[model samples]
Target: MRAQEMWKVSDGTGITVAVIDSGVKDVPGLEGRVLPGVSFMEPPVDHPDQKYPPHDDFDGHGTTMTAAIVGDGSAGGPQGLAPGAKVLPIRTSIGTPMAFAVGGEAAKGVRYAADHGAKIVNLSIGDWYSMDKIRSAVEYAQSKGVLVFVAMGNEGEGNNAANPWAMLPGVLGVGAVDENGDPLPSSSHGQDTDLSQMGGKVLVRCKKNSDWCVQDGGTSVATALASASAALVWSAHPDWTANQVARVLIQTAGAPRDGVKRNDYVGYGIARPSQVLLNHAGDPGAPDVDPLAAPAPAKTPTPGAEQTLEPRAESAAAAGLSWQWPTLGAVVAVCLGLGITVMIKRRRRRR
Candidate 1:
């Protein structure tokens, strides 16, 4: 990713990314950076004792993702890809019973972020089932000119089933790769995957505390980095529309080794933000023409209809390493790759 060099040119200033996940805490590194947002999940009826606030993290996964995107490393936490970017923390339940009972929570969160002042929305979660409510929300975000990035899932070595959110049109599906620039076996793949990034053996802030830890790799981490990469590019080119920013990311990504235009494993290749930030590469195509296919028309929600959705497991793999701060100099480089090529489909554009 050459993040250090890219920072010299643009440290993601004037950009706000919405992190829709478990929740984000006001940890040391993220003290003044995390903006207050809403929580879609409430305490379950059966487990009233489990009340998690919007700023509270249930699994620490959200905090880690937040840190990866914007942590300043002030308290020995992991350095963010876009240190100057601000984060809007929107909390949603994933592994809770309330998540299953409350359908369209993710949709609500996305809409909230878009209505607010977020230019980018990062969804580091995935679900097995596809819900119309969520799809409509994603389309709504795209219509609002907000870029949404989602994890493709970590079941690559298993069923590798498609994640509904990642499959949504106009959303950038992200996959994971390791330090060696090889795709991680656990990173899910499909035609929807638009980019890949360094996720394996990366350092992150632990849940419930400010300590640093290492994550073996997950599409969740890759997705957060992809969002931050967009922040860097958008920060440098504030005048560019969402379509133009998306175009540059795809155009500047590393080409696939097989010489094909795109592959299931790594998409266009890897997202190389440095190609645009440091080297002044990539073409910011037409501001109105979407680089990815345009999204389908949004369906109107039924009035007063109470929708319930089943929550799928999160895309992040369990943390394998124990919490401990390692030497900062020994940290592995967070390399980003892959770019999107314009593959416009003949779908009806959203109004």
Candidate 2:
């Protein structure tokens, strides 16, 4: 990707980016790039509970996005835009009900990521969360200078975008466009949309050793790409705040299409980092100003929230995998593979 080429001068070595979503797997491309993360699932407490760690990739969605954002170049997969960046994969929800409990788990996940020292947080998955909970956690991250990125929505259905959490006044909201530069059927339009798309009909690992390359259309993938873009810029300039960086991004957005300028369908335009790298775009205006944080009025809920989650017929549990750890009790359950369990070992309280 051009983003990688532009990152020659900068390395995301010290940048920690947390991916909060379905779960990330231990792909060959990301052996040591990912870190152990938390899971807030409600278990039987005393049962054979999976230690509930993050980065399991039950749906496989998180894995693909993880590769795009932080995968190191080992396998044939494209190297991440921020290859040196550390990915802190966390899980807020999974299964058919990815947005389980109205995003309670998600809010907690963001806080946990920030508390653990993630300079950039990527929410490739989105759902309605408690206003107070999400805003508070996000604000806390911002106060500490954390940059958060989110997907607008998978479908045209407009919802979570209006919320202050995923589509907060100050956070970055990402949208998707096909490789041909046309809007995808699934990308949410209006109000929540952000900019750019990479890898719609892209190759993503299905099971641990398998692969799937379909026209994956959704703001989720776009969100991760945008987050990775920010990571590239922020890693280059560690002194910039969330607002300053965001301002630069919006100000430096590239190549606008005819008949559109800053509309919700495509906020500003497709974000091209090359502009800033090449010095074609001027300085990104006021560093402390947040233009996207317009006085957004309160909004309502999405239709999907009213509907129950539809099972994709594929789950990590059916894959026959078990969670592993260096110790006896720190591993968490993994959810990915061809009905074959791949034990993922995680550790806490480092020895």
Candidate 3:
């Protein structure tokens, strides 16, 4: 493909993607491009309202993944798949060695996104199983028409079953691929998951004022790549529903297997976002119909699931300004006209 070919066709210009991970740093390429995000772990202290801050980066992982999805600046790393799209960084993970510890942060991020109005939610996280709170969050996003994409987890070598979070109906589970288009050792696999994208070896934004890049692997990268792909597709086909986009991804995935058969390793083959963005894939069926409607509550936090207050919460700022406003570009007219684009953020900031 041409340099930023996907970007030219669709730069995720109006899309607002939430980066749920170690806070994102404000890199030169991403400066002005990223909006104030949420930080759940840190107490805002004087800045009580801002649980999350704007253009923050901490462990470098969030920024790296953010670059894959939205960075277009040639600072010192690889350009993003969708340079024009805005990023809403959420400090969901502390880059901890364990996964359960971050599940709370991820849950907080999901609630914030749905409440704020992000159209597409990008979670470059793994190990947040698809059980109670997590499933509720995913269900809530789907009810609001938000298309949530998550990393399929980096347990492929350990024979980890497809990450349950990815298998959730409305959620898009992505796997990792090397530069040569082969599955990575760490990328998880499953059948119910959405698709696959480039996750193995690549460069990313280091931080603000620094254009330096680094090499990395894991489903986290794949999730970022897939998030950018969704932004491109959503930005172009403004009317397409979340289901339609998801259906296209599955229909056009790299390898097709009989039924929903998932290998103990790679999931439903690899996701080919190019197919949907390029309109080469088949229709995603119903616009109003949801793939995740069976088990979970229509919106979540309904009956049996545990309920908790958001780690942080804030009013929206402006149209296309919130980490939850993934459809900002698509709904800018509606939001601006209604003066409803209040991009408030709750949480903490890092780096």
Candidate 4:
């Protein structure tokens, strides 16, 4: 990615990305870079003793995601791709047992971030199911000129159902790739995937301890990098609108290996922010023209049905299992496990 070389041109100054996930901790590398955002998860009914503060990370997922975007490499911590950018933490319950119950809360967080001056929103959390509230919130963010990047999910070998968030209009669905630029088998694929980024063997701030850990890779990390890439470009061109920024990213991305415009596996190909930051490549088209076309509307539920939000499965963190990692001196390796999933339950009312 040549993040350091790109930094010589623009280190993402004056850009703010909202991380809507578990929570962001005030760690060494991210000092003075995280904003005091809000939390949507209430005290879990089954676990009232647990409290989720917006700036305090319990599962370590949110903290790692935040560090990947804006960590300044303080105290030997992982250096962020866009160290000059600021992060706005919006805490949700995607990694907790209560994840299935807070779909509306996550939607509310999206609106809160957009209204609070966030230019880009990074959603590393997602589910197999879609909620009307979430769809509405994504639309609202687009209306506010906020660019949203969502993880395409990690079920490539399984069902690989398209994540509703990624399928939403105007949202960039990110996939994962290895150091050699080969697509990771775990990265979900579909028509919704917009771009790919380094997601395998990536180093991130450990959620268990202060030392750095290596993540085997998931779309979550890729989404963070993609979001940071946008921050870098937006910082360099402070006058560019969200649409223009997105257009350049799509235009300058590493071309597909088959020499085609795009593919379901890598979208427009790997995201290379340096193309815009250093080489001055890509054309920022009309500010009002969106590069990604919105998909068709989802089928509406029956008029008198009871709706509820749920998760396809519980996360490893919710099971009280710290993510597994291999130790190498002070550094360790960890698996982010599966992509977070949310499901919606609906019941027909008696006519």
Residue range 1-351, candidate 2, lDDT tens digits: 354346665546678888776677676878888888777754543654655567565566667677777766565564566677888887755443324442566678788888999988887654432545666677777666787776766545433122223345446667665555555556665554555544255556555436644446366666666777677677777877766667667777643444334555556655655556546463655556565655232232331111111121111000111101111111121111101211211111001
Please, what are the lDDT tens digits per residue for candidate 1 over residues 1-351? 556667888988999999887788677878778888888876767877765677987566778888888887666666788889999988877545455533366778899999999999988775433256767787888888898897877767865553546766677888777766677778777777788776678765554445667766478888888899899999999999888888898888875655566677777767878889878999997887877764223222221121111121222122211111111111122011111112322242322
TM-score of each: 0.81, 0.75, 0.72, 0.81
Q: 51, model 1: CA deviation in Å?
A: 5.5
TM-score, prediction 1: 0.81
Error of 4 at 127 (Å): 2.0
Global lDDT of each candidate: 0.70, 0.56, 0.57, 0.70
The digit string of per-residue lDDT tens for model 3 on 1-351 reads 222344456768888888777777766566677777777654435654544453554456777777777665454555777777888877754543323446666777888887775778887664423245666777777777788887777666654444455655567667676655556666655443446666545664334424554445467777776777677778888788887776666556555233332332334446555556555566767787654343211121111121111111111000000011111122344334223211211011000
Candidate 4 lDDT: 0.70
Lowest lDDT sum, 10 consecutive residues, model 3, at 313-322
Local distance difference test, candidate 2: 0.56
Candidate 1: lDDT of 10? 92
